[model samples]
Target: INSSIRSTYFVSKLRRISQIFYIELTPNKNLIMSVNGIYAEDSEGKFIPATQRPDGTWRKPRRVKDGYVPQEEVPLYESKGKQFAARKPQLPVGMSPEVALASRSKKSGPNVHCPIPGLVVLEDKTKKKKKKKDATVEKLANDLTQTKLDNTPPDPAKRLKNLKKKIREIESIEARLLSGELKCPEKDQLDKVARKIEILCEIKEIEKQIYWPIDTKYDFCRRL
Candidate 1:
């Protein structure tokens, strides 16, 4: 019974030693163990020695199990956004990539930042155009008012004489049309008729103004 117990103890110790040896000879670099501590491969395929702290305790090397990567082997992180593509200018059709890049660099001035090849930043001109349009309309209105003031004679008798002369001229034009003496285009005939009507309406308005002038005092009393 004592021989069997001694053999069992010896077998257990031998198994432990074999397991340790097997771990050391394993193909997995991450699981490899050394005399000091765990070993890790660096970027240059060199094995980094285990670290130690000032307290005489071993500092653990970062490992896959710890969810940590070695500093030297960490990959650079990149964003997959469209703005990332904007860094490189696009080449125009029928142009070589080299020439396109060269032209883009030349056109992109020092102050401009990341200018796209085909895009142009244009200044907004809507407000300026609206202001110019408004000024033109105002000028046209002023010119029309000034023309009306210049055309009207200051003396009422002179204005009445002018109105009568326009009526006579329109009557002669109508008589020539009835007698088939004057030839005119359809549009010109219509325009002349319209002008005659406008002149008659203006003469009637002048007569009314002269014969029936409004009394402001009477109008105020009526409003009250």
Candidate 2:
């Protein structure tokens, strides 16, 4: 019985040693090679050590006859995206571009912290900022319209004459900005003034038409 036990122990020891030797002799599993004559470029910009991954992890492959080895080619950034029009790459054809982009661009990693609902207040404020800018522009346009139509000192001829006069004023403002005769807009007060002037100038001609009554043109000529 003791002899049988000793023999079994010897067999187990021999098996463990043989397994370790086999492991040491085995080729690395990570090295990629072509079954057919095709091989992928190493992408590492150097002969990838015949036995290593791009990340510098070691692997094993047959060395070429010439000591020089080819590296993997790097991909071009292709400022133009996915040019082949191959259904945006993610979806088959006939899908909407929007759906294709969304699907193809889907993130494929670990779970992330979005804080989306938490950003509600921040996004709301940002939206409000844009709205405020629009409202301010609207207000500025209104003010310009008011200025042009105001013949004040409330004089009829002066009010009637504002369009040409206003054009000159707008031009003067632009000249000042261009010539540096007007201090740079980086100055706060100047920026406000510049913003007001820009909106007024942009819609000046359009705004003028709104002020003039098309139907009343006959009446005005009659008055004249």
Q: Name the best candidate (by TM-score).
A: 1
Give per-residue CA lDDT, model 1, range 1-224, as digits (tens): 99998997786667557645644564654444545445554333435444545553444434343344456657776677755786754665455676556556766452223255444343346766887899999999999999999997687667877988978867887888889887763776657666876777667666666765654222222232
Please give the lDDT score for candidate 2.
Answer: 0.50
Residues 1-224, model 2: lDDT tens digits: 99998997786667557644544454542233433232323333212222334553445434444334345443445544556554355544455666544444544532223344222112355676898899999999999999888844554445446645655665677778889887754465455555554444434434445576555433322222
Q: After superposition, how far is residue 167 of candidate 2 from its true place, in Å?
A: 3.1
State the TM-score for model 2. 0.17
Model 1 residue runs over 4 Å out of place are 1-153, 185-190, 213-224
Candidate 2: RMSD over Cα atoms?
24.8
How many clashing pairs does model 1 include? 0
Error of 2 at 192 (Å): 8.7
Instruction: Single out the weakest 10-residue window by summed lDDT for candidate 1.
Output: 215-224
TM-score, structure 1 vs. true: 0.25
